[model samples]
Target: MKPADVIALPFQWGSELRHRKLFHPRGVLMSGRLERTAPEGEGLPLVSGPILGRVSKALGAPGRLPDIGGLAWRMETPEGSGKWDVLLASVMHGPLSRAVLRPILGWTGSEFSTLMPLAHDDELWWLRARITSTIDGGGLALTDIARRASGEGLDVTVEQALKLNEFQPLARLHFDGVVSGEDISFDPVVNEPEHVRLTPQWLTDFRRAAYRRSREGRDAPNRPTPEEAAEAKDS
Candidate 1:
């Protein structure tokens, strides 16, 4: 397995985050939403942009991957609620795309989905750290300091600490948000609790992309090409 793959295995296996509805009859709501609000910015943080771009290029050529520009959302769920700067650009996962809009589009029979954690403070931080690490090796280290300074006092497990240290950039989504349980609601798709807006055109494009991807999957085989087969045989 590739080095990145080997590193990612632990994260994948150790994670328990799963996608769920905005409201679950069996699930108890956490309280309020965690949030982060930043001054308007055009592109991603300068530190992580180039790094993420480099890694994502391996997944697909430009414009083919999922991109999020200036994503500012307020999530009020059972888990922590906060508004943060989400510079999610070129994510290659379908489920993740679905989760962003799961509350509204979920009942529409959309095939996309994502796994979410009941409490995801650490998970989200790590995900963001992994992305930032690409720009600088000190990504997690910097966060460690911030986490402590914030006084949330959440413990970082040994495994999580280790993952933070060993993480490499596989994706790029810069994040900075404060999480707490406050007046949070998930009904509004755009223009809600604060300075966040998701254009209808953008959502439409995303859905179209998902559809194209699905159609491609149904029409093609994922097998390696003849050249790859030859290389494998020789080895």
Candidate 2:
């Protein structure tokens, strides 16, 4: 895996918070756009989803946007029918203690916000990101990454000295199957590290919420989530 070279874009926090704005269609649809991308591209295809228009209509805020941050990757390989992709979106990219991180996969915020495709598998994984701290002088930071493995399971890992981004993704992803993007899932409630496996009820509730969002294709109710949509592309 090559080091990610990403620069932060200007981020807005208040907009998404207004009028429960993030829950509005626009917020969901914008997220959906980031979710849909062409696999043939170099890293993140950055494909926009078909429901963007609906989200836009639902979102009356002409200029307001959501507080989004994280990374996206399109794995290069010869194993699956289509290219495998990974997306990590941070709903709350703030500093919090382990107490806060344990529940929502270490995220200090809410919602189901990550989408990643596996080259050798057929399910989509939702992931979360937490910035550990800033490094001395490399425009980098030590970060802890988390994702669910199942409805009651999750996996956690770390990416040392990753580029910091306040708005856009913190880094670019280019892998040659070294970091397998296959059959990955995350569930904070039941998947926390053994020591912290017993998650709180709130975390479990949030997980269920995210699951519903993914299963419903919140932004495009007419379409299936990426996991179910995979067949349309491969078939």
Candidate 3:
């Protein structure tokens, strides 16, 4: 068996025993829109539209226990041909620090980042997001953010950087509604835009193995691939 698959066996068993996600077991879903705001000169992908997202405590901690925050979202490709899934965890925003996931007590004051680099058009990029809208409370919890979203909506700025600390705004993500009890799973390893690949192939393989086992443990169906979607449409 592959090394990654072997390493992921425990997580698969844990999820199966618990009947929940190994990480970020509890979360709330939101419906949002993404508007591209990057300048033309930036090499960032120009994709934007409606999005479905989730915010959660990574360890499923309760009562403000310190835990990693998770922000994952799904959006369609600009060409409408496929879908892309991006998952980020609360972490430092620096080039080096961005690779490590940091535990945070609150969601608003923390920065969420894709710990792995993405290779697009032969260039490496990192995606990050910060909450720009203010919540009446301290926004210490996911429920606080949900309450704020259901009211005036929540605004978050999505930024991308190419191998440096300088990040340019790529899009403005607005969450305006709450989605209840939606059983959705996002696998960036499997659901990515055409020609955009996750870098450090070994790590990608590791994530693929881990995600597959997690899904299997939960008895969750995998999302349709681009080819499957097309075939279904044609049928």
Candidate 4:
């Protein structure tokens, strides 16, 4: 195995012991629609379709604490040929700062970014989402956001940029309700569009290893906690 795969073993053990995802364990499942708003361009072809999404706080932090926000979703690709999964995290809108994820106290008015560039048609592009609607007063709870979405609809604008800070509208995402009883896990590394590729092969390898280990941990048979396993190993 590669060094990255070996190094990801602990995360697998951790998830198995915790019986949950190592990151973003808690989230709200949402049902939404993505409508293409921009004309065909040199960028990715943003498709219009029904979407299933999850909004979560990284580290599974409580609603009151600042946390890295996550917006992950799955949608159909052109001609219903396949599906594309996208995972974005809260990030700044500047040139250099856009690469860094920032924790936010609430979800509203936050900007989410791909953090890494995607190669489409031999050109690099970045995807982003901006929360355009307001949720009253520290709207951090899952149910609160769900309620608002079901009633007034939570609106977000999806954008794309060839370079940082020069985003153009790509689509409008509207969350109409909370999806219940459906467990969904998004792995963009494996579920991306066929025409597009994530840049930096090393990063993709690392992410693939991590995701594989996480899935193994989640699916493994019940085992002793990491501490207990370590003690047994030491003995």
List residue ranges in candidate 3 displaced over 4 A.
220-235
Encode model 2's per-residue lDDT on 88-170: one tens digit a residue: 44443332221121112222233223432212122221233333322122211112111111111221121211112222332
lDDT of 3: 0.83
TM-score per prediction, in order, is 0.22, 0.23, 0.88, 0.91
lDDT of 1: 0.25
Candidate 3: which pairs clash? Answer: none
Lowest-scoring 10 consecutive residues by lDDT in candidate 4?
A: 136-145
User: For candidate 3, lDDT tens digit of each residue in 98-123?
Assistant: 88888886666579988998888788
Candidate 1 Cα RMSD (Å): 19.5
**Evaluation by TM-score, superior candidate among 2 and 3:** 3
What residue runs in model 4 are displaced by over 4 Å at the alpha carbon?
Answer: 224-235
Cand. 4 TM to true fold: 0.91
Q: In model 2, where do residues sit more than 4 Å from their true spots?
A: 1-67, 71-198, 216-235
**For candidate 1, lDDT tens digit of each residue in 30-149?**
212222222223211112121101111112212322212111222332222432322222222332342352211110111211111111222231222122112222221223323332
Candidate 3 displacement at residue 166 in angstroms: 1.2
Give lDDT per model, in order. Answer: 0.25, 0.27, 0.83, 0.83
Candidate 3 global TM-score: 0.88
